[model samples]
Target: MTITGVDHTPEVLTVRWQDGAATRFHAIWLRDNAQGAAFRHPGNDQRLFDLTEMPDDIEIADAQIVAEGLEIRFAPDGAVSVFAAAYLREHAYDRAPATPDQPVWGAELGRRLTRHAYDAVRDNPSARKAWLDDVTTDGIALLTGVPAVEGKVCEVAELFGFVRETNYGRLFEVRSEAQPINLAYTPVGLNVHTDNPYRSPVPGLQLLHCLTNAAEGGDSVFVDGFRCAQKLRTEAPDAFALLSRHRAPFRYRNAETDLSNRTAYIETDETGRIAAIRYNNRSAAPLDLPFDVMGDFYAALRRFSRALHDPDGEMRLRLEPGDLVTFDNERVLHGRTGFSGGARHLQGCYADKDSLHSMAAVLSRKSA
Candidate 1:
């Protein structure tokens, strides 16, 4: 990239990068992010300068486009610094932030989703990369030929990230049982909802590998919470606003521990893209908005809840033995239909979102 021209204002330094794209950098930001021996330690890339001591009106005494980069001297200290054009271009904050490239989907996704063989994930690097892409874009993927052994789910998580161990342990068993500590252990139809809404920064991904599914009715169900939120925003703006604007309390308590958190049912990032969703009716504590908005909030909640239960917004799968289903815990609401007769067992675990992204970036770099 070539710097065609450079312009300086009292508070900003604007650079015209070639091809008509102009980028501006704040004077203070440039000073703080300078890449000189005096300002930055080369070994650790740590800053030696006390940025808090920087003046309110720091000015550029001089600036020139050098062959290597843009060389500049500040007014007060007269400190000379050179910023590589490539570095500046790469680090510019003027560009819009990158959002997750997730494609919202509903029931139709079930019919078209790709199924990879579990053996390939372990034996082939490219198959593991494809698994990464599936989780990134569609928020879900299936492995048809997983080994039907306990703890095999851990291998799938290791390809992307470490397994997240909670009170449920590193890997939890999903099966019907009496005196169930969690409803997931009972043979009942669970409401469509995201997991652990009571916890801040809930688990990012969930993997459920069926060891046995001899049941008559219990089938895996998934609903894209993001897709449902979009529908609610378009159809019921007021309700969507109510859910997004207010923080609803979610709580979970057992014999030994009590956990709670307050969060919006729908969360959005700076660019108004759906970031994370937490909608566990079983874990929802109570409606605690002001009395004036409480009724409206409840009404809005009902509307959103109905949309999630709508068949059109849900995808179903009958995961047989050796089938592993992985899904984004924040974007997808997962549940199961009640089962009767015969046995069904699944081994499940969680992984963080950042770790998955980190592995994907590394893989992309290697492949590129």
Candidate 2:
């Protein structure tokens, strides 16, 4: 990479790459994001200093291309740092996310969702990496041959990142009960939806390992919420706008807590790229929009819901004992068909996507 231009402004440092694309980094941001083991801990890779330790108007006194890296000196303090061209480019906030291009799928995903062996993922490094890759790109993957043991979900969770404990505890049980606290605990079929929309920051990745599925009509269902949003945008732009722009309230209330939040069903970045989908009909509270706008919101919401629950769009798969299913909760809505008197038990847990991506990045760097 070649630096075509270097504008050392007092506020920001603008560096243009070989492709003429420039990323302007605020001097303060650059100083805070300093690389190496000096500012960041080698163990956890977390910053060792707070922003209060940095000068508000810190300027780059000197910046020059040196051996494919940029050597810099901060003004006043004279603290120096070196940022590699590749590192700077990779960490550039202006650059789009490097996530791979993955097409959204519906029922058709049943055939395409790749399956991996639990033993291979646990025993082989390459197998684990490949499994993560498929989950990252496809938004879901299945693992057969999981050992039928309690807390085996943690083994899968630790492979990428730590488990995200919720009010449901670190891990939750999904089985038919006499008096179920959540709909998921009942034998009735659930509408395809994201989990915990009522939480301020909902879980990203979810793992469901079946320990027992000896039941009648208990097949799992999956629908692509992102695809449904895109379909609404293409077919009903007005409805899409209503669902994407208006904030809807979601609540999860019980004896212990009354968690609530208002969020858009469809979230888009500034560039209009679909960032996430939060669809949970069961947890949705009554809309608080004005009387005039409520009609439009409901109309749009119905359209989006219809698109998500379309029979042809659902991917039906009956998870047997020892079958572990993992999915992105933000993009994929999961449900199940009501079962008879037979027992159906599944161990479920949540993990953040940040950890999964961090593991992938580390492994990728090592491989390269």
Candidate 3:
């Protein structure tokens, strides 16, 4: 994109590109984003000075179209800043905001699950990039042919990022235990739920690798929590409002730890887009809402629970030996069916989403 013309007021600078599209950049924002060595560190691209260090009365004294981009002079300090047209176009906020790329899905996603061989993902860069993209786009992906070894899930976690250690340690077993502290260690069916909502910063991503599944019946289930929240928003607006506006208390207590957190069941970003879903009946604490709002909150919670339980919205699969599933813990609700008669073992670990996104971007750039 090339700047065709330049226009400026005291507070704003508008650049018209050759494509006939115009974009406006605030003087202060432009100053703050200056790419020169004076504004940003050449090594890390971080700001060298604080925003508070900037003069409040800063404004654009003059603007001119340059061969590389646009150049402007600040009024108060006469500081010169040059902005490349490409950079301006890339960071422009003049048009409608783009929607988030994460696509919500239903049961149909089961038919076309994002599946790849573990060897391919580990050995091939293109496969790795696509597998990561699938995880980000659909909030879930599967890798087959992983070695059915104990603690192998940690290796899978390192494929994208480091494992997020919690009270469960770096990794945890999912088989039945004689004296299980968490319900997950028992051979009982669990309702679909997000994991570890009581933690201050809930784990973003999770990986479960099936070591063996000779059990009678233990199938894995997943539901797109984002899809369910959107359904609630459409069919039961009041219920959606109650769940999104009010915070719910969650707790996990045993001899060693007593973690607690309070957050909305459905959280939205500043732009009102669904950001996360934290629903775990097992860890949920007593309702702390006012008496007047208690009934309404319960109704809303039940309605949302039913939405999560809807069979048409769930993707059920019996993860076989060597099958590993990775998913966004905040956007996808996962559960397991009860099994008996034989041994069923799986190892699981957690990792954040930021690293996954970072690797995805780098891989993309390399391929490009």
| Reference-based TM-score of each model | 0.89, 0.86, 0.96
Q: Which residue segments of model 3 deviate by more than 4 Å?
A: 99-102
Best by TM-score: 3
lDDT of 1: 0.88
Question: Which stretches of candidate 2 lie above 4 Å from their native place?
Answer: 2-61, 74-77, 92-102
Q: lDDT scores for all predictions?
A: 0.88, 0.87, 0.92
Tens-place lDDT digits, model 2, residues 85-138: 988887888667655323788788888777899889888877888899887877
lDDT, candidate 3, residue 270?
76
Q: Across residues 291-368, which tens digit of lDDT does each residue of candidate 3 receive?
A: 999999999999999999999999999999999999999999999889999999999999999999999998998998
Instruction: Single out the weakest 10-residue window by summed lDDT for candidate 1.
Output: 94-103
Model 1, C-alpha of 70: deviation from truth (Å): 4.0
Better of 2 and 3 by lDDT: 3
Candidate 3, poorest ten consecutive residues by summed lDDT: 94-103
